[model samples]
Target: MPKIALAQIDTVLGDKQKNLSHIKDYCRKAASNQANIICFPELVTTGYSLDILGTELWTFSELRGGETDQLLSSLSTKFDLTIICGFIERGGSLGEIYNSSGVWVPGGKSWKGTFRKIHLVDSERNWFSSGTNIPVFDTPMCKIGIMICHDAGFPEIARILTLSGADILFLPAAWCIHYKDVWNINCASRALENGIHLVAVNRCGKEEKINFFGDSQLISPRGKPLTSTLGDDEGLVFGYVDFNLQAKTRLELPYLRGRRKDLYNIDHSLIV
Candidate 1:
C-alpha cells in the first residue's frame, strides 16, 4: 500500500513566495503522516489569474531547473517523498509561457519529469502555449502521469496514459465553481474506463475574480473515492493507493485487458 496526499490549498494570485510556503507546509504534514507522494493544485505557486496578470507574470515563469527546481528538489530530499506541483514555465522564445508541472523525487536533486498542460481553454489561449505531448514519469515506487484542469475533460488523454503504462494519474486543477457536477462525472468516468488510480487535487477559495471549487479527491482504480475534501478550505487530505488492489481491479473490470485493437481503429476518410 502506498500512502499519498493531496494539498487542496488556497492560493494568493501572483504571490509566489506565499503560495510556495503553503505547499511546503502541507508537504511537511504529509511527510509526517508517512506519505510516499504529495501533490499540489494547478498553478500551485501562482493562482489561476493569468487573465489579470497577463504578460506581467513572465518574470515568474521558471526556466527548467531554475530556482523553483532547486527548492522542490530540496523539499523532496528533506521529506524523503516525491513532490508533484504545477508552475508557470518559461520557454526559449520571447513571450513563450506554458502551464506546466515540476516533478521532484526523493533522494534526488533534479526533476524526474516536467509536464506542460496540453489543452488551453477560454482565456488561457491568449496567455500560454499548449503542450504537444503527455509524458509519464517513473518513480522508485510506480509510474505516474500528470494532467492539468481542462485535460481532465478529455477521456482520450486518460486512455493514452493507461496505454503508455501509467497506473496512477495525477491531475492538478483549479476548477471553477459552476462545473462541479461535470467535474464529478468526468473523474469517475476516467478512472473507471481507464482502470487507473486517480489523484485529483483541486484548489479552494476565491481569488479576486475567480471562485474555485474545492472537491479534491483520491479515487481508486475501481472509481471508488478513497478520501475526499469538500468546500472551500485550505488543508491536506490523505488516501491509500494499493498496487495489488489496482492490478486486481483492472483484472475484474477487463477494460484494459479486453481491448481489441483490430476493431478499435477509427477511419476518418469515411466521415465525409
Candidate 2:
C-alpha cells in the first residue's frame, strides 16, 4: 500500500517563489505524515491565470531542469518522498511553452518524468501548447500516470494509461467552480471505467474571474471517494492505494478485458 497526499492550495498568479514556498510547506507536512507521494494542483508554480498573464506567460515558463525543477528535486531529496507538481514548461522551439507537470523522485538528479497537458482548454490555448504523447512513469511504489485538468474528461487518455500498466492516475487540475459537476463525474468516471485508483487535486480560490472549487479527492477503483477535502480551501487530503483492492476490483469489473477493440475504429467512413 502507498499513501498519497493531495495538497489543495490556492495560488498567487505569476508568483513562483511564493507558490514554491507554499509547496515546500506542504511537502514538509506530507513527509511528516509518512506519505510516500504528494501531488499539487496544476500550474502550482506559476498559478492559473493565463488571460491575466497575457504576453508575460513566457517570463514564467522554464526549460526542463530549470529553477522550479531544481527546487522540486531538492525538496524530494530532502523529504525522502516523491513530489508531483505542475509548472509552465519552455519547449525546445522558440516561443513554445507548455502547461506541464513534473514527477520528482528522491535522490534523482532530474524529473522522473514530465507530462505536458495534452488537452488544453480554450483559455489555455492562448498561452500553452498542447502535448501529444501520454507517458506513464515507473516508480518504486507503482507505475503512475498523469493527466492535467481537461485531460480527465477524455476516457481514451485514462484507458491508454491503464493499458500501459499505470496502477494509479494523478490529475492535477485548476477546474472552475462553474463546472464542478463535470469535474466530479469525470474524476469518478475515469477511475471506474479504467478500474484504477485516481488522485485528483484541484486548486481553490479565485484567479481573475474564475473560481476554482477544491473538492480534491482520492477515488477507489470502484469510483467511490476514499478521502476528500471540503469546499474551496487550502488543505491536505490523505488516502491509501491498496493494490489488493485495485486488483480485485479490476477482476470483478473487467472493463479493459472486455473492450471490443475491433469494433471501435477511428475511421470516420465506418460510421453509419
**Model 1 agreement with the true structure over 1-272: per-residue lDDT tens digits:** 77888889998889899988888888899999999999999998988888788777798898867877888899999988999999998887677899998789987777887899998998889989899988889886789999998999999889998899986999999899889888788888899998788998999999886889889999888887888576678788888888888888988999988889889788988888
Q: What lDDT does candidate 2 reach at residue 236?
A: 91
Number of the top-ranking candidate, with TM-score as the measure: 2
As for candidate 1, its clashing pairs are: none
- The positional error of residue 75 in candidate 2, measured at the CA in angstroms, is 0.9
Clashes of each: 0, 0
Give the 10-residue window scoring lowest on summed lDDT in candidate 1: 228-237
**Residue pair clashes in candidate 2:** none
Candidate lDDT scores, in order, read 0.87, 0.92
Best by lDDT: 2
Clash count in backbone of candidate 1: 0
TM for every model, in the order presented, reads 0.96, 0.97
Q: lDDT of model 2 at residue 210?
A: 85
**Tens digit of per-residue lDDT, candidate 2, span 1-272:** 99999999999998889999999999999999999999999998988878888888888988767888888899999988899999988887569899999999999888887999999889888878889989999876888999999999999899999999899999999999989999999999999999999999999999888899999999999999999576788989999999999989989999988989899878888789
Candidate 1 has a TM-score of: 0.96
